[model samples]
Each structure stands twice: as structure tokens, then as C-alpha cells.
Target: MIARSQRERLLEAAVRVVAEKGYGAATVADLTREAGISRTTFYAMFDDKEACFLAAYDNVAEALMRRVAKAYEGEERWPDRARAGLAALLGALAEEPAIARLALVDVGAAGPAAQRRYRAALQRLTPLFEEGRDFAPGGRSLPANTSRMAIGAVAGLIADELAEGRAEYLPGLLSDLLFATLVPYIGPAAATREVGGNE
Candidate 1:
């Protein structure tokens, strides 16, 4: 097999180090040790540990977002799109629990810049949720802020699940998240019906 690039090795090592030691306790030395690279190489590749971590966050978040987008594609109905997207995201999280914790949990604890990246990552999903407004039953549109909150709510729930080492169970949350996403626009009865079909 071809060897991974130095940058790729460093990012993967960063995720592992953060997952094992946590962002607050992890250091450049630890990351370099995990990557089997010298400190000099680490500096050559990244400005610092935080910089490397932020890059890792972007990498994981973008990859997961792409999966969700792909899963949602070709599904005209909103609920179908949502179920597909949610399942894609949860599957990714379950398959890469370390990366999931690094992106969803440790990134926020890395520092202010990481916090910003986490917010940006979460905001990236807002457009996906915002689209739900258009398909809301009766041509109803949810408040713009509510759509944003729904995105944040899903992130927060996922973060909590990851923090508790429940990443493998995220796929089970599809219906609950779908219900939450639909509730703001469609009333309870309709949202329940939407989530129940699971088509």
C-alpha cells in the first residue's frame, strides 16, 4: 500500500491523540509521538497543535457533510431526504468514533479558534435544515432562527452522545432528530406522521 502523506499522517495522529488524551491535555509532542514524526516535521507541517487540530476538524466535518449531501441527493420528499442524511451522518460517526469525538467534542475544547471552527462546522449544516422550511406542510415556513436552532440542537445532541461514548448508537437517533427538525414548521401531529413513515 502507498504510504500516507506527512500532512495526512499528522492529522490522523492528531485525531488519535485528541481522542485519547483530550484537546486540553494533548500537546504537539504527544501528537508528534503518535504520528511517529519529529517535532521539527510537525512545525514544518503546522504552525502548532491547535492549527493541526483545526485542520483535522475541517477535514472530518467536510467529509461527513459530503456524505450527508450525497445521501440526501435524488430524494425529493423532505422527510426521505432527512432520514437519508441523518443515517449517513450517524453511520460515519459510528464507523470513525475517534474522529467523531475529535470533531464533535474535542474541537470545542481545543481553544477559541477551535470553538469558531466548531460553530462554522455546525453552521454549514444549517442550509440542510433550512431547506425543510420550504417543504413544510401547508406551504408554511418556520422562523429562520428556528431553523438555525434545529441544526444546533442536532449537533448538541450528537456531541452529548459522543461525549458519553455512545457514538455507535447515533444511527438510532434518526427518527428523533427528524421529528425535532419537522416540528418547528409542521405541528406535532404532522411532524409525528412525517417521522413515522421513515421512507
Candidate 2:
């Protein structure tokens, strides 16, 4: 338990250090000092700065996933639940600007670990798209793979907007953009019904 706590503390410190200094400038000493742990403890916990960074990335992803899971709870319709989840996530990102930057931008520069983390998160998120099974109004069903791609695209757009400091308008824009883009693929009848339901 103590070991886990120390690892978490180190990951938190690593996030702060990376957010403040960028991945290129962040150092193990900086994270150790920020975590209030000795260098020996830091080294014992992580193989190196890169290893620490990967852990930090996982921590951020886990935090974001928790927010998503909470946002999705008790929502019946897939589309409605998706939009709410997106809004909650964007709101969380807006509130935690540093963490947002770290997750969306700094991690990208950290190497393969960043890409792996992104893929893992996307994989975890794919199941949410299955909720589209509720769209029986149009007699057209969305393929799970396509839904996953759509979700990934929407997430990518949100990350781009957040990185550019345009997150304030992202919720509405994402809703409209995703609706427009995905409705076509889902077919006219399904699209019409879904859009009508939103109004």
C-alpha cells in the first residue's frame, strides 16, 4: 500500500513537472523534489524518466476514464449519453488546464508510451459506442468498428480544440460536427430520427 502510494505520488509530481516544464525540460530531480521523495526512492519506483512518464500518462488516462464513466452513468440513450460524456470531459479539461495540456500535448512528445496510452484509452472507450444499439428508430444499425472510429475522431477533435485553447466552444461544436459527420454514415433515416430526437 505504501509502495503504491509512493508510486502515485511520484506520478502526480511527474505530471506537474512535465506540465510546467514540458517533457523535454522535465528531469527526475524535478519530479523527486516535487514529490518530496529521495532520488533513491524515485529510482526504485521507476526505471527511468521515461518509465515515470508512462506511469504518469496512465494516471492521467485513468482519471479521465473515471470522469467519462461517471458522466455516462444513468443515461439511457446512446447519443444523449455520448454528448453528455463529451461535455463532462471537456468541462473537466477546461478546469484542469495544466493536466489537459500534459495529457494532450506534452505526452505526445514523450515517445511510444504516449501513443500506447492513447490507443489503450481509445480501446477502452469503444464500448460506449455499442450504446448505439438503442437506435432502432431508423431500422439501421451502426457497426461497432465504425462507431469506434467515430468516437476516436471526435476525441481527437476535442483534444485539438483543447490544445488550441478553443475548448470553450468545443462542446457545442463537437455535438454538431459529430452529428453531421456520423449521421450520414448511419444513413438518412437513422440520422433524421436521431436529429429529431435532439430537438
Candidate 3:
């Protein structure tokens, strides 16, 4: 196979370094050493570690988001769509624990700009959750921030697992996540029923 470019190597290293040592502790030297590139090359590719990390974070988040959107496609019901989308996310994260941590848990500790990116990444999922409002009978009665809150609930559940080094078990959370995603718009009885429905 052809060799990866320096920029790609640096971004990969950024994710690895952050996953291993976290953003505050990971240094430029650590990134260079991990990527097997010189400091000069690292600087040439990225202005700094944060820039490199943000790029990697965005890459991982976007890929995961795309997987979820694709999984949700072809499903007419909102709950099925949410389940498919969430299952896709959990499976992807389980396959790459480091990227999972980097995308959710580590990004929070990466400083203000990284935090902003994390928020933006989470916001991108709102449209997926917002569709529930139209499907639920009590959709009009739900609070205005229901979609944002539901997204937070799902993210919180996943992030909790990642922070505890239980990324591999994320797929098992499908029911709980589905409940959280649906509970805001639909009552518990219906959310639980939907979660327990046929795959």
C-alpha cells in the first residue's frame, strides 16, 4: 500500500496521543513521536496540536454521524430510525475505542475551542431527534428544548461509558438510549414499548 501523507499521520497521531494522555497532558513532542514525524513537519502540517486534534475529532465525528444517518435511512418510523442510528453509532464506537473516547470524552478536556467543536458535533444530531416531535401524539406539549435535551441524554449515556473504559459495551445500551431518546416526546409506556419492539 502507498504511504500515508504527513498530514494524515499527524492527525492520526493527534487522536492517539489525545486518547492515551488526554489533551492537557499530550505535547507536541508526544504527537511527533507517535506519528514518527519531525516537529518541523508537524508544525508545517498543523499550526498546533489543538488544530490537529480538532481535525481528527471532526473526522471521527463526521464519519460516525454519516453511519448513523445511513442506518436511519429507509426506516419510516422515528423510533426505528433512532434505534438503527444509535445501534450504528454504538457498533462503530465499539470497533474503535480510542476514537470513541477521543470524539466524546476527550474532546471535552481539549480546551474551549475543542469544547465548542464537541457542542457543534452534538448539535448536528438534533435534526435526527427533532423528527420525533412530529410523530408523537403529545409532540405539541413537549418543551421547546426537548430535542436538545434528548440529544444530551444520548450523548451523556455514551460518554459515560467511554469515560469508564466500557466503550466495547456501548451496543448493549441500545434500549436505554432509545428510551432516553423517546421519553421526552413520548411517555414512558410507549417509549419502553417501542424500545422492546421487533428489530
Evaluated with TM-score, which candidate comes out highest?
3
- lDDT (Cα, tens digit) per residue for candidate 3, span 137-184: 979778889989999999999999998999878999999999999999
Badly placed stretches (over 4 Å) of model 1 are 1-4, 137-141
Cα-based lDDT at residue 93, candidate 2 = 77
What's the TM-score of each model vs. the native?
Answer: 0.89, 0.84, 0.90
Q: What residue runs in model 2 are displaced by over 4 Å at the alpha carbon? A: 134-144, 177-199
Q: Which one wins by TM-score: 2 or 3? A: 3
Model 2 Cα lDDT, one tens digit per residue, 1-199 = 9888888888998988898899988899999999989999988878899988988888888888888778877487666776666667777777777878677755678888687786787567666665555554442455546666666666677677777877566655645544643463565566556656766
Q: Higher lDDT: candidate 1 or 3?
A: 3
lDDT of 2: 0.73
Per-candidate count of clashing residue pairs (backbone under 3 Å): 0, 0, 0
Candidate number achieving the greatest lDDT relative to the actual structure: 3
Deviation from native of the Cα of residue 43 in model 3, angstroms: 2.1
Which whole-number lDDT from 0 to 100 does residue 80 have in model 2?
A: 71
lDDT of 2 at 73: 72
lDDT, residue 160, candidate 1: 91
